[model samples]
Target: MPLNASLPRRDAPFKLGATALLLVDMQRIWLEPGLDPDHADWGPDHYFYRQTREVAIPNQQALLRAARASGVEVLHTIIQSLTEDGRDRSLDHKLTPIHIPPSLEAGLPPKRLAPVGDEILLPKTSSGVFNSTNLDYLLKNLSIEHLVVAGILTDQCVDMTVRDGADRGYLVTCVADACAAPTPERHSGALKAFGGYCWVAEAAEVVARFEALGRDAAA
Candidate 1:
């Protein structure tokens, strides 16, 4: 069968990577609202990306707990303009104006350097992690195979990372309950679209897998 952008294989359970969690885009800016037609439902406090702030936040946190217990590396890829001139952001970000420059220009907001201590916060100008970042080198050095992805804007960042991971010879497991689009409909839609591309599992399932693995590893 031909590869469908909207379909993923339903046969195998995802093979875990070196056990790395590739978290994308949790900047205060991406969390902001826009009035663009594409973001008609987006507004400050409108709950457009509510699943992220509400559902995914807690779920991802629980996954993080499992990750730590399992000794999995956690990395964050946040989208931001590298320059005030906005040379990095695509026309989509530029036109959509999801965030004004300087705010997302890598200095201000909460996208500060790699979550302060152990977390590696990566800022990307593009959608895919391997597009220009050292993510490839980093993952390779760590011998990463399957990437457990969780983050905001499901159809965009989550989709891209899953696609790129598959292309780069890594298995991808996307925590569906721990993900969210700009809206609920799109969030669910992205899950359906990630069908053939990613092994979509609930956050609780991911945690359960890790816990079970931990017990097995100990035994």
Candidate 2:
């Protein structure tokens, strides 16, 4: 089957608040060949997965453009320990197994706390956003009420961020098309689980929403 053919297409118009599009852990290490999922002992069907080798990039690019045009805030989060000496990881970081393909121990470059200027990018050590990062403070200070999410590891970072955002009373939407993982099953499963805490929308739905908001603002 054509990889993305099974995905839903969305084109709805909705208003956007002072929303932020949070990009979670879409690092090169996660997408590039240097990080090999096959090494994880998964079968050929399970190895390297399809999302990175196929979909995701286009959806993310579209979301990025729409976010910039609509002037919605963009936030990024990455999982990286504080120091090479392991001081930043806390006991939790050390205790966590480093068997994952793109984990800190997998030689994935520790999240650099991207110097994004006005855009907020929080550095985290764990899967959950609020569990380790000051993202709560950043959101409250920005006075943001809505969150639009995109990034890699839909079953992990993206999933955790949306869950936390919703728990804290933010309007959370996950760009289902923009997130990547090793396989479609894992990606879809995460979307289903996070649906309780998020509105799982396609990239098109978010873009249309942003554009509609712009039109309403001008009208």
TM-score quality measure for candidate 1: 0.77
Q: Per-prediction TM-score, please?
A: 0.77, 0.77
Per-model root-mean-square deviation over C-alphas:
5.3, 8.4
lDDT minimum window of 10 residues, candidate 1: 105-114
Instruction: Tell me the tens digit of each residue's lDDT in model 1 across 95-150.
Output: 76543354544333343213435867676777777785888888889887767898
lDDT agreement with native, every candidate: 0.70, 0.69
The parts of candidate 2 lying over 4 Å away from their true place are 1-17, 36-50, 97-117
Which residue pairs come into collision in candidate 1? 7-196, 8-195, 8-196, 8-197, 9-196, 17-146, 114-121
- Name the candidate that leads on lDDT: 1
